[model samples]
Target: MIAESLIQRKPPTKESAVLRDQLLRDLQGAASVSEPVARQLLERLTPHERWALLKYAGKGLRDWLLAAYRDAELSAAPGLEAAHYPELPEFLLDRLQDWEAKNRRRLEARIKNGHARAPETLRRMMVEPIALARFIADRGVDRWETMKMSDRIAFARTRPKFAQHKLKAFITFIEGGNPFQTRRGRPPKKAKKVIKEIRQIAVLTPDELKARLQDARQRLPADQYLIYWLVAKLGLTAKVAYGLTLDKITINAKGRVVIRPAEAWFAMPKSIAPTMEKLARNADAQWPYETPTDAAAIPVFAAVISERRVGPEIFRSETTLLRSSAIHAAMHYGQLDRKTLASISGVSLKTISDMEFLVPADIHSLVSHDLVAKRNRAILGSDDE
Candidate 1:
């Protein structure tokens, strides 16, 4: 159930009410019952309506819409108030707001100059500073200037190195001209070696890889299975697959399914070509009012089970596991080199290189080279030689 406080909030204005009604009517023009309403559907809904729709929607719609909402929120300005953290002192809150406001102005200046940046960027910049500020306040430290290097180090130890690095901007802001720098450098070579060892051990054998693919195909729904197939076979990341558009997928003259994400084109596996073709047809047919070639006019994968629109956020947890398993399988089989793996999977070459240790050093083919040559000779006839 939606919270009573949420449901009890002020009702929509007459103008917005009419807009919502019109939007609901326009949604009926979509070509298929399974297709989502236009992208504006969630944007048109009031916050209360959005909450109700999310709660009542099927898994597919909720997943898609939630991701949309999050993206929208991140791009919008964030509210700054002690209400967000009631325990923080007024002075601490002021300091935090001051820091946030300074960054906000810089972002606004960039926007004014035509370099558009989402407030999410500012939010990211402020998050660690606010967290560190709160940490200092909680320890009864009233002034940031009074804090020592030891205090900063104490906080750094609790966060990942990347997050800890974010404090540099805050330190510069606080110290005016002389920013405090941490003594820490890149993680030691020993730590890097340990991580590489872990990746090597995570490699999957051929039989185990086959079992995983078979199990997923048998158990997952058509829409989800398609996602898994894309990741496992073509090495496309789940996010890339999820955002695939009708314009990005096509059938080449050779009767093969081709997918273009960004500028790169990859042909789909023959085993799954027919399914992809059908999905493309369905998606195109679903948007009768618009041309399928129109960028993002039709999402390649969408809700199949219900009218309620879902978001990609639903599959957040599983994407990593699917991606990791695919990488491990590829490494073990040694079918694709580091450069090829990076190109197809959108994984960094650095990461692919680091995981190269997973490939077996002494992998041997089942058939000897001479036996393979003899079989080829038998097939082709000695006369050809």
Candidate 2:
């Protein structure tokens, strides 16, 4: 009964040696405090595990660690915490483990039902990180407050006309008001259909595309890079980009980016190939649920990083799988014909338009210049004015 209380997941390392030494000192009176027990635990569990045992089972020490070790030795990869994320509070991990175990069924169902966008919602926040909230607030961004739709669109880097349902779902999640929640909602857009075809998607200009790319390359990680790269650069939707298969993306003999037998080739950045390969290697960890061994045909952005790793069974959160600001970038920057973008991404023309943040050319041009002017002023003088 006491053994069940101190459920340490990892073994003890030098970092936890002090706790272990203290535990050993406290337990020297016990007959089971033998060298073999220490060795078995050291060889089996992690530094964290040792501390947990010391704290919990220290009073009523256990031979349970040895039995647990024997059981694990029977398995091939009994430990997958080798590739752990750093700086996560122990309490946060505890909550994650509990949630992972409890919500396994629900999570699997979500993956099945295609709930792959914005998996990082803080549904389990015990204590909000005041420092992080303060930092964003210091920059005049109050993460706690509900963001204006325009600001949300700007922040998402997508168009003003959002996929109403998807954005609404995301907003509902955010309106839960946790510090890590998105905390934004979609603003109403006038229901105007430009051409009744694909003219609804706002196209991005070349310069705007470059700027978006530069901003994205600097701000986003590999997975996010793929999302925007496909949407902003290649004109794919966030969902489409998130779910894009490697088989659907390839380079042809013509030295251009092409979707293969489905359509024509398009220009691609030189750096994309390497990133795709890296994404491939990490895909199993990120997209572990019912994933195929042959990952080449898998979704491009489906890997799970440790910070967001959800479970022993599923491995990562799919809730935050796909986020898109691409439509906004496309409409405001790429300015490609809506039909062309629709063709590239296979999203409905109307849906694309609805999700697009249609900034007029003059407004768009002015926004671009203002950013440049701000940058110049920061360098030459001051932006205080």
Candidate 3:
């Protein structure tokens, strides 16, 4: 038995060890590896892992691998082809294909609207002719119609390159109905549970606000701290705070800081209204100017403006400061309800509700009116009549 075992076993050798080490080095340097090196590496991988590696690799690495190993038997894995994603539910697939087709039609409309040619890169990608047409045909024109004319044209020119032909083929395969002619009934009113998950607002306690300010001052640079204070404390949006001119902010005779809005800044007052009021009051209390001085003498917003002459000058375009402050404020304390918070922030209520990507929080505190109305309506049922 011992003699038979010895005959069956193959001993590890120096040559095999060297080959294993070289293969690892090649894998480690996959990013910078040349096409030939990548092909050689792929040849060593098991058939199963080869496809996995190709799919998971970064775009550049994958391209290099493909260029290097194109000679390999691609047909070896018929299971991994694009056509093998399993037939989705007919209804679902039809819906998706309809959406794509409508999107394509809208793009064609934009092209007919006299938009300029697409960028060279987009043209090379074949986004202009093929993919967009299929997309419009499937998706319909609602979303595309809402976009600005210039933007619509841009979309028309660039969507074809990625998988235009493939998308067209998919649509053809599905026998999907025309997206434009498919009249959708009014969508069901969203359940409270669904809305709760999507829209949220948070209110910060005084202590929470203090902690956030402390963290901001400690963590952020000096210039950024000032901007943060203007947003988090005063409640200015980044654009408004950055657009502040020296002339807009002044200490009045009554020892109150006054912030007269600039034309550019006045157009939108969502984030700045709170901060603007707070900053004015604080400035007046902290540094009261008894008499009027030249507009240049006063500090415009918190940020420094380049020119002393100030009609509509930007203070500092440090948008990240506002974003970071808002994020920190939300994470530390919580988010506010959309409606109530929107009122406080001076943003449109509709805008708040529509924003889907925002972090979820209980918005009852922000939009108590809506909650109250909803509850009251539920209590007074239709059967009561």
In lDDT terms, which candidate is top?
A: 1
Per-residue lDDT for 232 in model 1? 60
Model 3 has how many clashing residue pairs?
44
lDDT of 3 by residue, 1-385 (tens): 1123223223244533344344445576752556466556677776434534443343344444444444564311101111111234344444444544555455445545744222122223233323343444454432322324454455546655554444443333335444235557997896476344444444444566677678867765544455566566545566544445434665545534455432111222343344554544332332223432222222334323222322222223433444344543543345444433333334455644544234355445555685666644443342243
Per-residue lDDT of candidate 1, residues 280-359 (tens digit): 76544332223324422245574343212222433334556556667767766664444446656677766666555566
Comparing 2 with 3 on TM-score, the higher-scoring candidate is 2
The Cα local distance difference test for each model comes to: 0.57, 0.43, 0.42
Better of 1 and 3 by lDDT: 1
lDDT of 2 by residue, 303-323 (tens): 322222322212122222111
User: Top TM-score: which candidate number?
Assistant: 1
**Least accurate 10 contiguous residues by lDDT in model 2:** 74-83
Which runs in model 2 stand beyond 4 Å of their true positions? 1-212, 221-224, 255-267, 281-297, 304-337, 352-385
lDDT of 2 at 65: 41
Displacement of the residue 294 alpha carbon in candidate 3, Å: 10
Using lDDT as the yardstick, the better of models 2 and 3 is 2
Candidate with better TM-score, 1 vs 2: 1
